[model samples]
Target chain A: MSGLRRGSVCLGLCLVAALTANAQTDAPSRRSGYHDMGKPLQAMQDDDMANPGMLWVGEGANLWNQRFAAADKSCADCHGAVQSMSGVAARYPAFTAGSDQPVTLEQRINLCRTQNQRADRLADGSRELMALTAVVAHQSRNQPIAPPDDPRLRPFIAAGEALYRLRQGQLNLSCAQCHDDNAGRKLAGVTIPQAHPTGYPIYRLEWQSLGSLKRRLRNCLVGMRAEPYAPDAPEYVQLELFLMDRARGLKLETPGVRP
Target chain B: MGNAVHAEDGLRPYRIVGDAIPAPLTGEAGDPERGRAIVANRRVGMCLRCHSGPFPQERFQGTLAPPLTGAGSRWTEKQLRLRIVDAAQLNRDTIMPPYYRTDGLERVAKGFAGKPILSAEQIEDVVAFLATLKDQ
Candidate 1:
C-alpha cells in the first residue's frame, strides 16, 4: 500500500510539470499588468463602495462656487444647483446629434464656453479648466457609467481600444503594463492605482489642482515616455473612449483627490 | 630609419611636423570675461545650484549634479555646448534641468520668446572659460 501511494504521488508531480510546460508554450499574448486584470473601473465603481475620495468633490464644488474671469459667470450661475446636474455626466462620451461624433464632458464644457458663456476658451488641462471640469464631474457621483447605447459609438470605442494597445515612446511601455498587469504593485514610490476612471477632477497633490480624465491620460502618456497628445486631439478622444469602455459600470468620481 | 637623411645632398633641414592637429578656436567674440559675469550673476544662468565651479566663496550650491571645475578638459567644446544647449537632447534619462530651449517652456517675457535662457554667444563664452581648465 505504501509503494502504491508513492508511485501515485510521483505521477501527480509529472502531470503538473507537463501542464506547466504546455501552458507556457501555448500562451498567445503576454499582456502587461495594465490590461490584464480587466475592468478595474467596473470593480472600483461597483464593488468598492467606500467614498474615500469624496473630499476632492468638495474642493471641486468650492472651485465651481467661485467666480470666473471678469464675466462673473460661476458654474453655479448657469447650472443653478448641482443636484440638478446629477446624472448628466454618465451620459457623456456620448454621440452628439449635431456633430455625429463622440465628445467627452470636457469637450462639452469647452463647447459651452464657445457657444453659451461667450468666454475665452480655457487652455486644455489648464488649472481653471480642470477645476470647472471637476466641479461638473462631481455632480455625477453615485451614478453608473453606462455604455453609450448609440451605434455611432461603436467605431469610436474600437478606435479607443486600438489606441490603448498601441505602443509608443522611448520606454516602449504600454498603458496596459502598470494599470493592467501590475495594477496594485509599487513602482518607484507610489502605489499604482488601478487606472480606473473613477477618480477624475482628482486633486493630485503634485498637480496642486483638480484635473479631468483626459488630463490624467496625458500624464499617463508622459509617464510612459510618449509625447503628449493635444487636449482636443482625436487620438485622445479614441483613448478616452477605450478607457471608458474598460471603466464601464464603474461609478464616476469626478474631482477625486489622489496622492 | 634614424631620422634618415634624404638621398638628395644637403637636404634642407626636414621640418618633421607630426600628425596634423586642429587648432583651438580663437577670436574676440570668445570672451571668458563675459562668462565670468554670467557665472556670478544669480539672475542669469544659475548653474551653480547643481554644479560647483571656480566661483570663489560660494557656499550655497546644491550638490545634485557634478562639479564643473574641470569640465573643459573632460569634454570637447562641441560636447560642452550641447550640454548647455539641452541636457535632455543628449540623454533622455537625464534629470538635469534643460537650460536650452528644447520645448514646453511658456509664459516667457515677450522679447525672449523662442530664445534659450542663455544666448549662443554666452554659451561660447562659457565654453572658452571651460577650455582653460586643461592641465599644464
Candidate 2:
C-alpha cells in the first residue's frame, strides 16, 4: 500500500515537471513587431503627420460622423463622440451572448451596420471598411491587448491555437514555425516578425496602402503557398483572438507603418 | 511509360522509385556553374531563404531548416533530385516547397497557377549544383 502511494506521488511530480517545461517552451517572451523595424519606418509610425495610415484614420473619423440615409443616424448618434471608444480595440475578438463563436472587430462593425444602422455592409478590404476600422482601432492606440475573459471563447481559442500550429500548403510550414520559432531569423534579407496583430489598418510599404489584419493574414497564407480562408472566415478571427491573447501585455500600435 | 509528359502543365514527367527520381527531368546534363548562380540569386532559386551553405558573400540566411553544408555527402544525386522536385512525397510534414510540382496545390496565385516554381532545366541545374557540395 505504501509503495503504491509513493508511486502515485512520483507520477504527480512528473506531471508537474512536464507541464512546466511545456509552458516554458510554448510561451516564449512576448515582443511586438514594432521592436523589429528600422528607424525611418518607426518614425513614420510615431509621427501623426508623417504616417500614411493616418490618412485612413482621418477618413474613418468622417465616416463615423456622416449620417447614412437608410438609418437616418450617424455612428456618433448611438456611440457618441468617437473618443468615447477609447480602449475598445484592445479587448476584441470577443464573444457575443447568442453567437456560438467570437466576432472580430470587423465583423462586429458589419453586424452593427446591418442590424442597428440599416446600412449596407462594407466589403472586406474596401476603402470605407478599412477607413472605419482604422478610426476605431486608432482609439485604442498604446493600450495593451486584452482578450476578453469568457469561458465561451475557450474552445475557439483552442481551435485557433491548433490552426496556428498546424502545418499546411505545399511548403508544409506552420505559423508557429515562422512567427514563433524563427521570428528573429532572416528570410530573403527581411527579418521575420513575431506577428502580433496589435496593428490593424496598418500601412505596408510593399502594399503602398493601408490594409486590415485579415489582408495581412492572407499575404502570409499565400507566402506559404496555402489556400487562404475567406475574408469573413471564422479561422481568421479565431487566429486573431489567439494572437491578441499571446500578445496580452503588448501595446497596440494601430495605423502602424511596416516595411 | 518511362518518359511520359504531364499534359495539363506541360511538365516533363519522371518516374519515382524507392525515394529517388532515377532519371533527370531534362534530357541534357545541367551546367554546375549556372546551377550555383541560380541557388545564390535571391529571386531565382530562393534556396538561401531557408538554407545556409558555402555562400560567404550572402549576408542573411534562414534558420528554419537544416544547413546545406553536408547535403551532398548526406544524400545521393538521385535522392537530391527527388527532394528538389518534391520533398512532400518523402515526408508529409516537410516545410520545403516543391520546385517542380504544379498539381495538388491549393489556391496558387493566378499568374503562377499552372506553372511550377522551377522549370525542368532549372531543377536539373539545382540538382547538379547540390550534388557537387561534398563534406569538408
Candidate 3:
C-alpha cells in the first residue's frame, strides 16, 4: 500500500513538473482562425479551383509579366519568377535600411514599383494591388510565419503590443479582451478568433471579394464603434508587425477564404 | 442640471451623482415589456452579444461580460439607469457601450454622428426591465 501511495505521489509530481515546464516555455496555445471555420469553408479553402480569391491571383500573374508604361519594365524584369518569393511573405513587415520604420509587404511592393518600375503607387484597396499581393503571398502558402529578428523592430513590436492591449471606443474593449482572453468563446453566434494575421489578401464570404489585413482591421474598429485610422497610418503597419510576430510558426494561407 | 436639454447634440440630459444617475432622462417611468423586447433583440440593445443571462430560447449568448440573471438584486434601479446611460462613468474599461450620451465621442459614422445608441425613453425602459431581474 505504501509503494502504491509513493507511485501515485510520483505521478502527481511529474504532472506538476510537466505543467510548470509548459507554462515557462510555451506561450498560450494558439488556434488559427481557419480551425474555427466550418467544414464547408475549410473545403473551399482547400480547393484552389473552388476558391474565389484565385481569380485575383490569375490577374496578378498577368500583371507580374506585363510591362509598365513609365519605365518599360515589368516585375519579371527584376524578380525572375513568383516561385522565388517563397517564404518571403513569412518574414515581412521587415525593417529595410534608409527607411526609419518597418514596411509591410504591400509597402515593399509599392516601393519596388516606384523605385524599379517607375510606376505610380497603387491605391490602398485597388483591384490591381490586391491581385498582385494575392499572387505574391500565394507563393508563401504553407510556410510558417517567421517575423524578422532585427533589433530595430523591437520598439515597434512593443508599441503594437501596447495598442493591442489598450481599451478604446464607446464599448471600451481592447483587442486582447476578445482575441486573447476570450478566444474560442462565442459572441453573437460567431466564435471570437485569436486575431492572427496568417492570411492576407483573403477572400471573405461577407465581402465577396479579396481584401487586405488593413480592411479587416478597419472592420473591427468600426464594430467597436471606434474611429479607424487613416489608410497610410503608421499604426496599421505597427499592428501588422505585432500580429505577424504573434503568429510566428503558424502556416501562411494567402487568398484564404473566411466566412 | 437635473433635467436639462443638451443644447449641442439635442439629447435629453440628466445629471450624474456618485456612481449612479439619480434621475431618469424621460420624466415618466418606462414600459418593462418594451424594455424586454429591446434586450432580447439583436439590433437594438445587442445586450446578448456580450452578456449571457436568463435567456433560454436565445442561442449563442456572449461570454464577454457578467450574466444578466440577477441584475436587480445586485444593483438598484438608479444604478441600472446609470449603467444603461453610460457604464464608463463607473468603470473606465467596461465593454458596455453608452446607450444614451452622445457628446465626447470620437469619429462616429456620418449617419450616426449625433444620435445616441438608444433614446431617453429606451434607456428608462431598459432600466425598468433590468430592475425586474431579481432572481438568479
Model 1 chain A: which ten-residue window has the lowest total lDDT? A29-38
lDDT of 2 at B132: 89
Candidate 2 — which pairs collide?
A: none
Interface DockQ per candidate: 0.04, 0.50, 0.50
Candidate 2 iRMSD, 1 decimal: 3.1
**Candidate 2 residue-wise lDDT, A40-76, digit = tens:** 8899999999999999999999999988878888899
Model 3 segments beyond 4 Å from truth?
A1-28, B1-23, B41-43, B52-61, B69-76, B101-116, B133-136
Write candidate 2's Cα lDDT for B53-97 as tens digits: 789999878766677788889998889998988888788666788
Q: After aligning candidate 1 to the native by TM-score, how far in Å is the CA of A140 from where it should be?
A: 1.6
Can you tell me which runs of candidate 1 are displaced by over 4 Å? A1-79, B1-136
For candidate 1, the docking band is: incorrect
True contacts kept of each: 0.00, 0.46, 0.47
Highest lDDT: which candidate?
A: 3
lDDT of 1 by residue, B11-128 (tens): 1112111221122222234577877667656547666644566766766553435677778778766566556554554465454544444245422333444445565567667766
List lDDT for all candidates, in order: 0.60, 0.84, 0.85
> Of the candidates numbered 2 and 3, which has the greater TM-score value?
3
TM-score (C-alpha) between model 1 and the true structure: 0.49
